[model samples]
Target: MMSFDLIGRLFGSVRDRDGRADVLEKLAQHEPTLPAPRNPSAPEELLPVALATKVLAGWLANRQQTLVPHTLNFRVLGPAQADLLLAVMAAAIQADGEIDSREARQLSLALRRVGAGEDEARRIGAMLAEPQHLGTLLTRIQEADLATHAYAAALLAINRGTRVNRAFLDYVSARLGLVPDVAGSLERRYRA
Candidate 1:
């Protein structure tokens, strides 16, 4: 129920007197109550669909369980794909979203399951610790080469399942300027 003016007094950014006055007048006329305040820098507050796709891609490509017991290999993915996925995974885990401990454990196990050695896994874990914006991370994914794009799209489709709608596929394909078949193939290959 606190007024904007009241909250603004404590929060320094709402300093424009005339603008604040207009806002206050509108609030007074409406007699509105304060909405939930958001943390300006919290990762959880921002989960743009694009960013979520990137995170899901990283989790699948680098963390999914494989059928064959292959030796842990960081070389399996190129640098661009690896970097993009690492950033997104870190952001998702930190996003004010709930990541069950079991899921976290599974993700850890999957990281090992992919045959990622201790050093590589630790390095990737370090990358996940780096602070990054979701938009920036998504930009990296969007900018990858065709091979990286194919791999990432496959992982995304697998992790997102039915959530990977036509609109989302089109968006990713358009961003890559790739043929629809490429994206479709990825979806088929990684069908959940």
Candidate 2:
């Protein structure tokens, strides 16, 4: 989920480190080896990732930047988590029963550029059926962090003013067991 192109967009310094062309080139050149999922019961599971997020979140807060950007990296995601993100992104784009849009095209391009293969793309296309698919995706999210990430990704994918988009988000919030306040906070971050 942590697409280098995405990380490059959010963090200018990272993009600048090797030059823009080089950063995108890395995406095509190397498929990042995502680490296997950690034992959830263990306290130190993905400690570096958690710490890095905390640090970036803190740094962004200090600089008056929105928290949304730092939290969007899917690089640390395991297979199930990655699938969930792709599914939600596709669902949001298709929620209103219409999938033709610039957003849909952009997502397709991003997913491909990030090296999503034919299988995952097919799964995402199949998963746009709604309530059941959304429920199925939510179940794969065991960690609270993952649930939050998926919800955030959905929020980013959606056009909030659309009735179907709003409804899809409402269902996702309830199904994910995200409390109203936490859900509101996530929404507000994207709204900003």
Candidate 3:
């Protein structure tokens, strides 16, 4: 089975400047590896049950697919991993050194959507209510995709009529080990 770590590295490599050409070269040189199917019977302790259920439900809803609860295919994220993802996002929301009502609402909605308990969500909120250091939060990610997604989420929070700091963005991209172009693309897409 292709491990998540390996998958993350592969994704990072392919997200570089010559990503498409690199992918074609990789395909020509070797057989592509596929990820293992999501095993519903696998232990669910990796992710909190409520969170996992919510993720599965959202995925199904997006695809307009219906399946019995017990038979749904969902990838389970470790509790620590999930927490790190949320923390990174929280840091992003607070990246500009302030969290307005709109940002707070966005964070609350995100926490609820992920099925976080009030106490846990509040803890995260409290931590982010203060000034956040991008490097500190980016250090928590072990996977490139997680860092990328978290950064994307944070950018969304501050991309409205606000001046984004280029240095902060560059620092974050470097801390997360993302290709420069990927960060550039995100900046172009989200910059107001």
Please tell me which predicted candidate would have the highest TM-score against the true structure.
Answer: 2
Candidate 3: tens digits of C-alpha lDDT, residues 30-143:
766776666776566546977978988898664322221111011244566555666666666665676777777766665555455576576676667565565656765634
* Cα-based lDDT at residue 179, candidate 2: 76
lDDT of 1 by residue, 13-123 (tens): 454564456545655687555577766696665768569899788867754233212232345876655555555545544443444564366456655544545655676
Candidates sorted by lDDT, best first: 2, 3, 1
What is the per-residue lDDT of model 2 for residues 1-192, given as tens digits with 9 covering 90 to 100?
667657756667444553457656766687777769756887677788799999888886654334334355555666777777877777677777776575566566655544566776787777665543555567776443577777877776656787778898998888888778678877877551
- Candidate 1 C-alpha error for residue 32, in Å: 80
What are the RMSD figures for all models against the true structure?
A: 20.8, 22.2, 16.5
Question: How does candidate 1 score on lDDT?
Answer: 0.51
Work out the TM-score per prediction. 0.38, 0.49, 0.44
lDDT of 2 at 67: 34
Q: For model 2, which pairs clash?
A: 1-74, 1-75, 2-74, 2-75
Model 3 whole-model lDDT (C-alpha atoms): 0.57
